[model samples]
Target: MFAPTFNLNLTLRRAVLAALLAAGSSVAMADPLHYHVEIDTSQFSGAGFLDFAFLAGNSPAPGATATLSQFSGAFGALDSKEGNVSGSAPGTLVFGNGGGYNDWFQNVSLGGRFAFDIVFGGDFLGTNGNVGTTFSLGLLDQSASAYLGNPNGNLLQFDLMPLNGALPASIAASTYASIASISAVPEASEWMMLTGGLALIGFALRRRRVAALTA
Candidate 1:
């Protein structure tokens, strides 16, 4: 009788262990956060349209780096300028006129709002300043493929200053002015797996209790 009871307990323990492992794996499958950017050019005044823009950081004196890509929409077909940057520095890729230099007139218009998305796998909080990072926008003319300035060599830039106060200890996955951030949540499948694991653990406990009572 002792041998049978010992075996029953061992089996139940193993079931509980397996369920815990499954739940652990489910929690580990969360995705990274996504940051969104929206630029309003309706009030922007230039001979040609607002072709492209560059985003870079300035705080923590080179805080974080990221990759910028243009998502599908009105400006998707314009050109693809994707590259990496480091610590508030600028990355490669021209946002207007196929990255060609000296073609400002052919630039895209910012008469309304221009929006895009970027991803950064780094911390936003700064160690040296209240606002860890300050992002600046550089707008180039259609005639200029270069990022810093237009063909006439004039630099049109906009700075997205950091928050007035200290950076938040934690930011929720949501939208903000000119920028939006989203963090990964568990998928339905992951949630289901976790729930199933929990159920299995409960069932194992119930079975063990039944066996003990019978004994």
Candidate 2:
């Protein structure tokens, strides 16, 4: 009688709910990816400008290609080859004297949360005391300039230091290399929101399915 029909409706509604839940769970979002960046400068000259200057494709040199890592200020990764790279010579360095290198810009893209870590070796600081001459790693906003010493744009410079005894003859010249470990995770609230949205959608879909079946 009515009891059998009622039980049928209840079972159908439960089945619909289970189906919707399964669908939503299948589409559940995942954690963002973490990109670890390591820059290999051994092959390239110890000079940042030399490395930056001749970075394969953009360099005046022909048919060159280098792998560059990048990060976005928020929810993205920085690409070395894609983001703009530049620097200034303190007039004391051997290879980069008289502005030997021109800064180049590379556009990069990434997904999810982003940040950068930097590493350095003794060569970067060189045998000069001007260890203050820094290598930068960060996302440059549109307003930033690729030129040396612009001082007006948003750029993150990672200061370089020399290794111990790297310059036995000239202790003043300290050098270093850079390696960065990056970690990016989605915002907790964002994850919660995504889960909640999925849950709500699942509930609605199940209810609709049950209603249609019953009708």
Candidate 3:
């Protein structure tokens, strides 16, 4: 009878093309996130050299200014004997000079550490669906009017969201502490499209069991 309806329409079109290749390999498997920013300063007594600026806002609301241009240029040049301080924009970070000694707080000893790498998906956490979304970190010193006031004490703020199910990796800011690490590998072309969709549904069920054993 038409070869049993052409083998049941070729096994329902190879099981609907293996469920659309496993739903496009789970939407191209995207999960990569690593961010670390540590600036403890060992209790920071502050003697000279304290210019910290790392601002990023998406409306957590607490003086949300918003300026995180994908970590701008990724902190390239700034070698105060390799202590580092050269950030005009792009999540700047400059806490005390290294060795240059400019006069406006560059005497050294402000504490260290600054690392950056981001990939949180969803257009970088815009949260269109709105399960959760909020990122705010504003710490400003920039010499605070030459230290007449606000001497790098009461300004450091952080309001990163995402809990329980996990997101807000880590952040501790009195002087500085931000650690966000998330890695969910599956790249290699999504494992070759999930092994070529299970080898095309195992070659279409072994060619429909050899065409039903030669009918």
Give me the candidate number with maximum lDDT.
1
Q: Superposing every Cα of model 2 onto the true structure, what RMSD results?
A: 18.4
Look at candidate 3 and give me any clashing residue pairs: 49-96, 49-105
Ranking by TM-score: 1, 3, 2
Ten-residue stretch with the least lDDT total in model 1: 96-105
Tens-place lDDT per residue, model 1, 111-209, is: 555555554333333323333332334455454464323233322222222223444322223223332223333445656766776776687677778
Model 3 scores what on Cα lDDT? 0.36
**Model 2 error, position 63 (Å):** 26
Q: Distance (Å) between predicted and true CA of 8, model 3? A: 4.9
lDDT of 2 by residue, 117-198 (tens): 2222233233433232334333333333332112242223332233224342111111232322333334445456556656
**Which residues of candidate 1, in runs, are more than 4 Å off?**
1-32, 38-63, 73-106, 110-113, 123-131, 136-215
lDDT of 3 by residue, 1-215 (tens): 22464765676587667657654553322222323333333343343343333333333312111122233211333223222224333444332212222111223333233233322322323222212223223222334344312333432333332232334322232322332222233546656766776776676777767767777
- What lDDT, from 0 to 1, does candidate 1 have? 0.40
